[model samples]
Target: MFRSLWFDGRLRAVLAQVLIACGFAGVVGWLFWNARHNLMQRGIAMGFDFLGEAARFPISEHLLAYQPTDSYGRAFAVGLANTLYISLLVIVVSTVLGFLLALARRSRHPLVAAAATVYLEAIRNTPLVVQLLFWYSVVTLNLPAPRQALEPLPGVFLSVRGLFFPSVSWTGDLVPLAWAAGAAVVLLGARFVYKRRHRAAGARGWPWLALAAGLLLWGAWQGQVGLQSQAPVLRGLNFLGGASFTPEFSALLLGLTLYSAAFSGEIIRSGIAAVPRGQWEAARSLGLRPWTTLRWVVVPQALRIIVPPMTSQYLSIIKNTTLALAVGYPDLSFVITTTINQTGQAIEGIAILMAVYLSISLSVSLFMNLYNRRINRTQRP
Candidate 1:
């Protein structure tokens, strides 16, 4: 009977999965019951109804309009947005910087290679919080006042408060809409033409240039160009009207990006190195130039190795955004912490925070997995 059951592959698989699920459910059920009993004995409520209660605390850096009288749910939303914003910013910056550093490590120049190595080592070895504090408190705070701010360009300023640049105000709807539509059309056309030409011979760089120029010209012709800048203007002992970047956000973003980039640089370096030397030789034998070999041959092979590990690093960056609490950044964790303390609803606050992070992480994983599958499908047999 055992042999017969084993021979029935579907039945055997189903039995195994069911047994494993039962064991997992039993463990989870026991934990839940034990926790509930403990809470009851201590006279502590364990439900999530407290999330509806008013959060009687001030949030300093709300992206949305929020007041102390706002509900706990609004506070949770504010926190989640801030966390996501910082994570997104840091990921973009770190990926760009890390890729550059990785390329630098592979440079023919000895000095460039040494410099890249040193940077990688220093950043990886330092504690992230310490680096954040140093950048925020020691570096940014020590900069000159607003009146004496660095003005490298007209209407743009950099100071201890934050970097300020002119922002465009959209007045006319049709002009801006038309410009956007035209730009999209140009970009799509350029991409199509470039891909067609590239598959044929790969010797045309003008399509991209033409697309960019066309977009710029179209946007300029539209009445969509307007500039206004209000850098920190000192009034007595304080500044006004300028976009103020809180030290918390600056520190959190800097720390996460710098720390994450170190690992990313190493990942990239390893990925590039993992591309076999024989592949390099093969490319050269095909009469490809050195630059073309790297661009078309080595890098593509390296990307397959690079992407999986890079996805993990990206996830780490997202999770580390929660560390904003340490530096008093009003990220999700900090908001949730404050909410819990004010409302005495620890369970609800913690649950919401966990759910938000889980959702964000799952979304990122889903996107990356889709891209990974596409890449895998395109790989040479």
Candidate 2:
């Protein structure tokens, strides 16, 4: 029986894979044991007990509320929030900028095409770190000080410290805002379902949009909610009473958006190019306008090619947010570094950082893959 099993190709393959997996697990176990033993010998502790301890470090900018007395876990959460906020902004801005760049490059106008080409070449050839540093210098060294800040628009101030603009706040009941948000979400969901079911009719979501707006207006009126806009005013040496973007954050956003957009533009351009010329001819024969053809036909077909590489580009941008450290922006990795320095729990801190990044990357990939599959399904007969 043993001889026969060894002769069976399928059985042999299974046995070989099992052996490989076992060997890998064994090696990993040994490495862990060795590391633990060494650490014990040096009296270094393990585990995550430090999470509840106060993290005295300061975070410059965060979406979530944070204080110096907050626990290490809270500080990490703040860092993760900052990372996500910047990454989300970069992804959105880059995608739009990239689409424009791709279109300009494909334009028949010589000057437009040349300008796009020049921008792409220059951006793509340089290291992203250098671009980030250069932008940092422009914001920090070249910009005017707060006392002599430039007012580019009403209630907008640009200075070495940062860009400050008016922020709107709803001074009213929270219940109305919650109801309005819920109504908007429901309307959007219904619109999505309508689009999927009636693909041929090309249903517009304007009605849904209008309904959501009406609901919001009604809610605001009932709740007596009023929007209060607070503009920044020069206060002594700095600006006060408005939302502001720090110099570091502004530099990081500008650098990441421009840098990622160049690559995204190239990827989009290639995908568009990959579509057969016959597709364009077919679109033209249908008497469709150029913009309509590109929008409805060419782009949808090109998406099959675009999505895979674009997923990678997005993942890269997420990871690149770590470069925030160079500009002193307190992203997840930055927080991890500080945690390690303060607590000497290098292993735990690094593990948390890796896990957070891995989770984010996987989530993004899964979403894009689903989107890719949907497009692929639509293309099938």
Candidate 3:
């Protein structure tokens, strides 16, 4: 049996793979061991024991209730929330602005296309940190003082102080809204499953799926229509606000959004340009309107090229949120830096920061990969 196994090509290949795996594992183990030994020799504690210590420094911008006396763990959580909020905001705003700019690039008017090209070039050529600083300076220096805040809309004020706008404030019981949301989710989930099954069976249910989604949303909205709401109003000195954005945060958000959008616009234009010329000719020959041809034929195909690169852009947007520190926005990177300086645990602080960022990137990649897979599966005959 041993002689037969040795003579078999499959068995030999398997043995080679096993040996390579063991060698790789040994190398990794040795590297880890050497690092640990060096760290110990330097008397630098590598454990995460400092996460529980009190953070005596103040974070200027945080989502949760965090005091200077809060534990580093709590500070970390606040910083994380701020990071996530800014990231999400940038992703959405950049995506919409990017698509619009992409459309402008393809506009029939020469002025529109030229303007978009100039805008895209302006953003793409400059470093993002410079853009952040520029916006910060503009907002802080150019805007009117709070006493003479510019009221762009009634109850909304913009000034050197910050931007103040109304936000949704719930005054009634939230249980009903929760129930409606739950019902909508169940309805949408079932509809999604039905669509998947039909898709696998090579049957189409576009109208049914649309109707189901519309009904679900409509029902949810109707159920929550009577919920109490509040709106912010302008007060004497400052706005009696629903939500207020500090100058630092506003500038950081604007800079990131505009900068990311330019890159996204280039991705979109490339995706749309990738479609075969024959597809356009075919659509035009069928006597379809320009908009109809684009919506029905061109854009759908372009999405195939757009999704993967767009996913990378989304991850980039999240990673760039770290630059908020330059604009004085207290994102995760800023908090970690302060924590590192105070605690003298540079290693642990950096490790935590790396882990958090790695997790966020992985999460974005995972979601986008799944979406891309669904698109691929549906495209396959």
Candidate 4:
């Protein structure tokens, strides 16, 4: 058996792998030991027990109400939530805007295509931090005081502080409105089914719109649209009575979204390009309108190509949210930094930051991988 093991190619490969892994482990262990020894000699604590200590700093953008008396653990959670909130909002806004920009890039009008190209290039070339500061200082901070706020329209107010819009308050019974909208959606679905069954253009292309309008009108008539505006009121030297947006948060989100959307737009463009010219030609030959062909044929195929790379851009935006610390945004990294300074727990703070980022990256990767697998499985042979 020993002779056979020595002679077998598979056994030899396994033995080689084992030896290499053992060598790597030894090297890593030696390096870690040397580092720990140096840190100890320098009187730096390397353990993570400091994580349980009281964090005596205030977090500015905490999702849950946090006080200076909270523990380091609680501060970490607050920071994590803020990071996630910004990332979530940016992702949604960027994806929608990017898709529209990408579609515009394929427009028949030369002006539209040129404008899209310019926008994409402008966003992509600028440094994200620079853009963030530009928006904050030039756009947001330069606006008039809340009392003298710029009103773009009746219910919307913009100022140096933040945006103030009419907040929706659901009053009357929303059940009827919900039922009406749901029924309209169901009817739209049924129309599609009927079109497929009968092979006819369904109701001259306005049935869905009419259904939506009818439902909206019915809902409004029933007083289901309960919304009121509490305009920003000047209180002493500051604004009051409306939602306040911190400049740091706004800057971080704006920078992240603009930077990420550029890449997302490119990914979409490339995905559209990946669809064969023959597919477009075939689609056009079928008498389908340009919009219809794009909706029914091109986008579905492009999505398979677009989604994976798009996920990477999303992960990048989430990671880039760390840059918020530079602008004093109370994101996870900022909170951790404060915790480190107050507690002198470098190892603990760094460990917590690393763990949080690693978890976020891993979660994103897992979801993207699952989506990629699903797309690959459904791909045409």
For candidate 2, give the lDDT of residue 96: 94
Give per-model CA RMSD.
4.9, 2.7, 4.0, 6.6
Candidate 1 per-residue lDDT, tens place, 66-148, comes to: 98888878888888888888888888999888888898998999999999999999989888777777777753678677678
By lDDT, the candidates rank as 2, 3, 4, 1
Model 3 misplaced regions, further than 4 Å: 1-44, 198-237, 378-381
- Kindly state the number of residue pairs that clash in model 4: 0
Clashes of each: 0, 0, 0, 0
Local accuracy by lDDT, each model: 0.78, 0.93, 0.87, 0.81
Better of 1 and 4 by lDDT: 4
Top of the candidates by TM-score: 2
User: What TM-score do all the candidates reach, one by one?
Assistant: 0.79, 0.91, 0.84, 0.79
lDDT of 3: 0.87
| Colliding residue pairs in candidate 4 | none
lDDT of 3 by residue, 142-257 (tens): 99977888989977889888998777654444565566566666766786798687765665557656766676556556555443444456566666657789999999999999
State the local distance difference test value for candidate 4.
Answer: 0.81
**lDDT of prediction 1:** 0.78
